[model samples]
Target: MQAIHKRLQALTLLIAEDDESTLKWLSRVLSIYFKEVRVAKDAMQALELFKESPSDVIISDIEMPQVDGLHLLQKISQLSPNTIRVVMTAYNTPEYINIAVESNVDFYLKKPIDIDEFLVAISSSVSKGSILSEEIFLNEDYSYSYKQKLVKKGQESIKLTKKEVLLLELLLKNRKSIVSIEQIEHSVWQESVSADAIRMVVAGIRKKLYQGVIENVKGLGYRIE
Candidate 1:
C-alpha cells in the first residue's frame, strides 16, 4: 500500500458514499496516500463539492439516498466527465452493471473491499488518466494530447468530460464555420440528437468556459470563433 499510496497521494480524489463506516474505511485508506480526499455522504453533496472544485478521480457507491451512483455519474459526465470514476456495489445486478458500463465507469467493484486489490485497481485507473486519446486538440484556445488525454488552456490545464472534449474537437475542426446540429450529433455521439440535447451540452461547456468560450449562432450550429 506504500507505493500505491505514493501514487494516489499525488492526486486529488473525491469519494461519494452515504455509509459512514464505508466512508471511514475509504477515508483511512486514501488518507494514507492521497494529499486531499474530498468526501460527500450523498449525491447532492457530491454534486455540490464537484461544482465547487473537480477532482482527479472519483469513487462512488452505486446505491445511495438522494442521488444514486448512476444519476451522479450522468451529472459528472455532463460537468467533469474526464475524471476517473470507480463504482462500488454490494449486489451484482445485471441492470445496474449495464448502467455502469453505459456511464463509462473505469471500474466496478463488489463490496467487501479487498485493500490490496482495490489499491491495485486504483493504481491502474489513475495511470490511465482520462479515458480516451489525448492527441486531439480543441483549437487554439484548448489543446489536447491524445497520449495523455489531457486538455490544456494556455498555461493552465482544464478538465473536460469525454463528451465535452469530443464536442470541442468537432467544433475546432470546423472553426470559423457553422457546424450543423446534425453534423455535430453524428460526429460526437454517432447519432442524431434533439436540439435540447445539443443545447444541454453547450450549456455545460459554457459553464466551464465561463466567459464566452463558445459562441452560439442562432438557428445554426455552434462555433469556437
Candidate 2:
C-alpha cells in the first residue's frame, strides 16, 4: 500500500456502499491515503455529495437499496466525465461487466477486498490521471484534448457525460452540415433513442459550453457552428 503514488493522496475520493462494516473498513484504509474520503451509505447520498463537490474519484458497490452502483456511475459519468469511476462487486457476470463498460468504469475492486488489490486499483486510477497532450481548439471558449479525453473552458473543465462527448465529437466531425437524428443515435447512443432524449443531451452540452455552441436544425438534427 505504501508503494502507491504520493500524488494519490492529493486527490479526493468518495466510496458508496450500503454495508456498515465494509464502509468502515474502506473508510479506514482509504482515508489514510486520500486527501479526503467521504463515505455514503447509499448511492443517492453519494450523488448528492458529488453534485455538491465533485470528487476526483468514486468507488461504488453493485448492490444497494433503491439504486445500484452501475446506475450511480452513469450519473457520475454525466456529472463529471473526467472523474475516475470504479465498481466494487462480488459478481463477475457478463451482465455486470457490460453495464460497467457502458457506464465507463475505470477499475473493479472485487469483494472480500484484498489490501493489495484495492491499493492497486487506486494506483491504477492515479496513473490514469496525469498525461501531457495538445489541445484542439473547439471554439473561443473551449478546447479539447483527445489524449486526456477532456474539454476545458480556459482553466475550468466542462463537466460532460460520455454520451455528450460522443455527440460533441460527432458534430465537430460534421461541422459543415446537420448530422441527422439517425446519425446521432448510431454514433453516440449506438441504439435508437427518442428525440426528447437526444434533445436533453444536446441541451446538456449547450449548458456546459455556451448556448450558441450547438445549433439545432429544427426538423433535421444538429451541428456546431
On TM-score, the leading prediction is 1
- Report the lDDT tens digits of candidate 2 across residue range 173-207: 45556777866776677678899999999889888
Which regions of candidate 1 deviate over 4 angstroms? Answer: 131-225
Tens-digit lDDT track for model 1 on 1-225? Answer: 666675676667889999999998898877777668899999899877765555667888988996798789777665544567788889878987898999888788889667677678877765664422325445557666543544677788677787787787666544556766756766667666788888888888777666476788898778776
For each candidate in the order shown, give its overall lDDT on alpha carbons.
Answer: 0.73, 0.78
After aligning candidate 2 to the native by TM-score, how far in Å is the CA of 6 from where it should be? Answer: 0.7
lDDT against true structure, model 1: 0.73
Best by lDDT: 2
Q: Could you tell me the lDDT of residue 6 within candidate 1?
A: 57
Instruction: Tell me the spans in candidate 2 whose CA falls farther than 4 Å from its real position.
Output: 1-5, 130-225
Clashing pairs in 2: none
